[model samples]
Target: MRLRSIVLIAALPLAMLAQGRRNAPPETPSTKTPAELRAEYIREHYTKAEYQIPMRDGVKLFTAVYTPKDHSQKYPILLMRTPYTVGPYGSDNYAGRLGPASEKFMREGFIFANQDVRGKGRSEGTYMDIRPVNPNKRGPKDIDEPSDTYDTIDWLVKNIPDNNERVGMYGISYPGFYAAMGAVDAHPALKATSPQAPVINWFIGDDFHHNGVLFLAHAFNFFSGFGRNHPPDGPNRDRIEMKTPDAYDFHLRTGALANYDEKYFHGQTEFWKELTQNDTYNEFWKSRDLRQYVKNLKPAMMSVGGWFDAEDVFGPLNLYKSAEAQNPGAKNMLVEGPWSHGGWARPDGTALGNINFASNTSKFFQDDIEFPFFLFHLKGKGDGDKLPEAYVFETGRNEWHKFDAWPPKDAKWKTLYFHAGGKLNTAQPAEKAEAFDEYVSDPAKPVPFTPYIANGMSYPYMTDDQRFAASRPDVLVYETEPLESDVRVAGPLKASLFVSTTGTDSDWVVKLIDVFPGDTADPQPNPTNVHMGGYQMLVRGEPFRGKFRKGFDKPEPFVPGKMDQVAFDMPDVFHTFRTGHRIMVQVQSSWYPLGDRNPQKFMKIQDAKAEDFVKATERVYRTNSAPSSIQLSTID
Candidate 1:
C-alpha cells in the first residue's frame, strides 16, 4: 500500500499536466466574452470604497475607489476625474468594471480611483463644460481642474492606506480633458498620464465644431445630454427628440439654426445657446482651449488618439505638438491608431468596418504601450522605454511604426492638382487652360454626410465607403489611377481651392479617399458585412465655413461669380494608398445635418429663417492662374 501511494504521488505532476492540456481553451473560440471574464475577475479581486474628496476651493467631489483585497504589497494610484457620473450610487455597490485600462491594471494590483468633477454628478458645485484654467490663480479659493486634481492627489497620498507615493492619471474625451488639465501644474505624486483622445479646442476642432464649421448632429445630441443642467435627482440621459429617422430630411425641414431653440430646446440648454452666441474664436472659446495651458508638464505624458477618430483627433496631435513647442524638456509621447473615438478602450480592435488592421491593435496598445507606461513611471515595475516617442499605426498597410518626431522629419511635400474631367494628378496645370468645374448646391437638397440611415452622428461614417457620396452630381469626384507604387501620406492634407459661388455665403467640404480596386481581396471569410471591393474609404474629410475663408473672426462675403481663394488644412492622414488602390478627392458645398446649412446668403446664419435658404451654383477653379489642388505630406 505504501509503495502504491509513493507511485501515485510521483505520477501526480504528469496527471495534472495532461488534465491542463485537455482543458485548454481553443485559439479561435471562447465560451465567454473578454468583458464578461474581466468583470468577474475585477469583482472577485477588488473591494468598492466611496468618499467625498475635498478640492482646493472647499468643493467636495464624489469619488469611487477600487482597491485590491490582497495586502501583500502597497500599490500606486491611478486616478480619473470626469464629468460623466462615476456611480453605482452606494458604498457597497461596485462598478461593473474597474481600472484605467481593462482588468490589466486591476490584475497588476493598483488602487484605481474615479471622481466626479466639481459640479458634476454627485459632486457639489456648479458644473462648467470644458472648464477653462485660471492661469492667474493665486488664492486657495480660486480653483480649476488642475487645482482640483492637486488637492485630490494631496488627500489620496496622505489619507489612503497601503498606497505607494506615486500616482498616474488617464481618461478618454471629457475625462481626457481633465487628464490634460491635471498635467498642467501637476501634483508631486502625479508621475504619469495618458489622456486618450482629449478634447483640445472646441471652437476650432474636437467635437462641437471643426475650423468654425458646426457639427450639427454631434453638437445637438451632446448638448441635450452633457450640456444641459441636471437637478440633483435628475437623470443624465436626456436626449433631443429626432422628429424623423432621416437626419438630412429632418434638418432641412427644421429650417434654420434658430429652430433648435425656438422649437426643441426652448432655451433649456444653456451651453447650446452659448455656443450659438459665440460664432468666432473669441476670448470665450480660446480660453477653454487646453493647448496654450499645457506647459511645464512634469508628468511622463503619453497622448493617444486615432487616425479615424470621429472626435478629438485634433487634440492628441495639437497637445503633443504644443508640449514639444512650449515645454521642450517634458517627456511628451504620442500614439495614434486607426480607431474611432475611444475604440482602444474596448476589447475588440482587430478591424473596423471593411478594413482589417490584421492584429488586435487595441490589445497591443494596452499590453505593450499603455500598461507598461504607468507601470514603469508610477510603480517602477516595468521597462521605461516600452512606449516609444511617437508610436503611430499606419492604415491601409495595417502596420505599427515608431518615429523620432511627428509629421516625419523626412516627408516630401507634393501637390495633387485637379485636372479636367475629374482626373487628379501629380503634374502641374496647363498655363492657358483656366478651367473650372461647376455644381449646383441646393440647400433644399443638400449632400448627406453618409449614405446610411441614422439619427445622430455615425462614427462609422468616418471610415465608411464614400462610393455613395461619389455618385452624387452635387459632389465633384476627382481620382488618380490605381497607384503604380505605394504612396504613403505622413502629415496633414491641405486643400487650396479657388472657388466662386452664385450666393454670398457657402461651405466647402473636401474629402481625401482611398479607392480600393474592384479585384482587391478582403480578409478570408470576412467577419463584417461591409463590402471591401471598390470601397472608397474616407481617409480624411473636413468642412471649412466659407465666410471664415479670409479669417476665422472676420466674415468675408464671396463676390458673386468671381473666383476667391478658400484654402484650409484638413486633419493629418497617416495612411498609405496601397499599390493597387487609387487616390480620390470629393468636393462639395454643403454636408447637411452634419453641418448647419449656409442659407446661401451671407448674413448671420444662426439667425437666418427658413425662407433665407437658397440654392447656389458653386465653381471650383482648376487652372494655372487659379489651380485647385490638394497638397499632401508624402513619405518615402
Candidate 2:
C-alpha cells in the first residue's frame, strides 16, 4: 500500500531487526532474545539528542541526532533529510538502528542525524513536494533543500560535540531528493552523498506519472494517505477506505478521472489537484526536475537504484548521468542491483517474486560499496580511487559486473524488429507492402497490468510473469528463437513504434520479456507450485501517451488510420538471456488501472466524459519502410 512507502532506513524496530537476522542464535527461557540484545546494544553504545535546527529561511527542522557513547574520538556526521518524520520523538526514545543501511554503520560509529524537513513532523514552514531548487539565491529568504542542508551542516559542525568537521548525506525516495539537492554547491564539510532511488521528475518518469501518463493506482493510493495536511508533529493521515480489495475493479468502477475528486478526494487533496491540472510537462513540472540542477556538484557522489524498482527507476540512472555530465571529473558512481524499490536497504535481496539473483546482493552493496564509499570520502579510511564508475548486477546470469562507464563503452546499439507470424528478429522486415498487427482496445475491457488482484500497485509486478497479459487478445506478442549463446543487453531500451489508431489518441505499452525453456525446472520448494517451463518473465515495461509523441510539452491528436511514430526511452537494464532462453516482446494499447484510461480521444483525459471513452482499433506497422522495433544497447 502507498507503493511500498518511502522506506525509512533507521525506522526499523528492534523486533523487525531481530526477525531479519535469521541465523542469529535463539534465546533460551533465561537468556535475552535477539531483539532485547539489539535494543540493549543500541542504548549502551549511543546517546540520543533532539534539536530544532534552523534553516536559512528561519524555519526550524526537527532533527534526531545519535552520537557514539564512546567519545574518545570525533566522528563524521552522517545526515538524512526527509519529509517523513524523524521520530521515536522524545530524546529518551532511541532508534533501533542508524545510518543509510545495515547495523554496520552503527558498529562503525558515526554521528547519525535524521531531520524532518520543512513542514512535516515537528518541522516549521510549509512543505512543498519536490521543492524547486532556487538557482539565484539573493538573500537568506531564498531557501530550498540545498540551503536547508547547508544550514544544518553548518550548525552540526560548529555546535555538535565530538564532531569531525566532515559530513555525509544519503537517503532513499523523497529523502534521496534531499540528499541529491545537498550535493549541489555542497557545504565544504559535506564530502560524500548518495541518493538512492530519488524522486527526480514526477511528470516524466517517477512515482505518479510516466511520459505524461498518470499512474492511476499508485498516485491515487499514495495521495490518499500522504497528500493531506495535518497539525505539525501529528500522526500520518489515514488511508482512504476502499470499498473493495480488488484495485483493478475498484479503479475501473470509479469511472473517469473526474470521478476520483467527485467521490473520494472531494477537492481535499491539493497535490492530486495539481496532478490533474498539470497534465502536460509544463514549468510546474520542469522546475522540479532534479536532473537540471545536479550541475557542478562538489561532493563525492553515488547514485543507486534497483533494476526492478517499481518507483523512481528513472531517478538514479538519469541523476547519475546528469551528475557525471555536469560535474565532469567528479567522483560520481552508479550502482544498480537486481532489487526492487529500496531493496538494497532491506536485509534480503536474493530475489524479487520468483526471480532469484543467487546472492545476498544487498549485503554486498552495504558492506563492499556503500560502506567503503562513505569511509573513503567522509572518514579518509579507504581507497577512494578504486571504486568503479558503474557497479551493476546482471540479471539472468545473476552476477555482478563493474564497468568504466554505464551502458558499457563496448556495447553496441542493435534493433529487434517485429515481423509477421509473431516473429521477432534482428533482420529488417522484408515485406514491401503495409504489413501490420491490429488489436481493438476497448476501455470497457482493458488489459490488466498484472495477473493478480490487489488494492495497490504491487511492487513485484515489475518482474512478474507476462503469460497472462500475452494471452489477451488486446495484447500483441512477438518472440525470438532460443539464443545460441548468451545475449546480454545493457543500458536503456528505445521503443520506436510506427502506429495508427481508429481514435485520435491512445496509450502504447511495451514489455520486454525472457521466456524460460520448456525443460526448465521449478524452484526446489515452490509453495505456489508455479510452473517454470515457458515462464514469460518481464524484464522491463513502460507506457507512452500517444499525444506526447512529438514532445512532452506539445500534445497533438493523431490522424485516424494515418501512420505515426511513437518512440520513447525506457529505463536501463543489465540482463543476459542465456542460450536456452527466448527473447520476447509484448505490445498493448492499454495497461489498464496501472495507467489511467486514455479515452482514445484527444482531450484533457481528466475531464473526459463517459461517451469519450470509445473502442479504438490500433495497428502497429512492420513494413520494410515502417519497421517497428525496440533498440537495445547490447554487449556482443
**What lDDT tens digits, residue by residue, belong to model 1 across residues 1-636?**
232233365657887857855896544444766566666666777887889998877789998888888888999999999887887778777777776655567768899899998887789988888889989999989998889999999999998888998999999998988989889899999999888899999978788898888899888878777656565535665566786787777777778899888978888788898888898878898899888888888998999999888876799988888888987877899999988898888787887766778898988888888988888998887886666689999998899999988889999888999999899998878857658899999988888988788787887778888988888889999999988999999988899999999999889999999999997676688656567789999999999989898788788888899889999998888999999899999999888688878888998878888889889999999888888999999999
Worst 10 residues of 1 by lDDT: 1-10
What lDDT score goes with residue 51 in model 1?
91
Which candidate gets the maximum TM-score versus the true structure?
A: 2
What digit string (tens of lDDT, one per residue) describes model 2 on residues 1-636? 111121342467877766866755654443655556666767878899999998877889899999998989999999999887887889898877788776668877899999998888888898888899989999989998889999999999998999999999999999999999998779999999999999899999999999989999989988887857555566655558787889999998999999999988888788999998899999999999989888778888999999999887899999999988888888899999998899999988999998888999999999899999998888889876698999999999999989999879999998999999999999999999889999999998999988988787888998899999988999999999988999999999999999999999999999999999999999988997888899999999999999999999999999999999999999999999999899999999888788999999999998998888999999999999999999888997
| Model 2 CA deviation exceeding 4 Å by range | 1-33, 229-231
- Report each candidate's C-alpha RMSD, comma-separated, in the order given: 4.6, 6.0
Q: How close is candidate 1 to the true structure, as a TM-score?
A: 0.93
RMSD of 1: 4.6
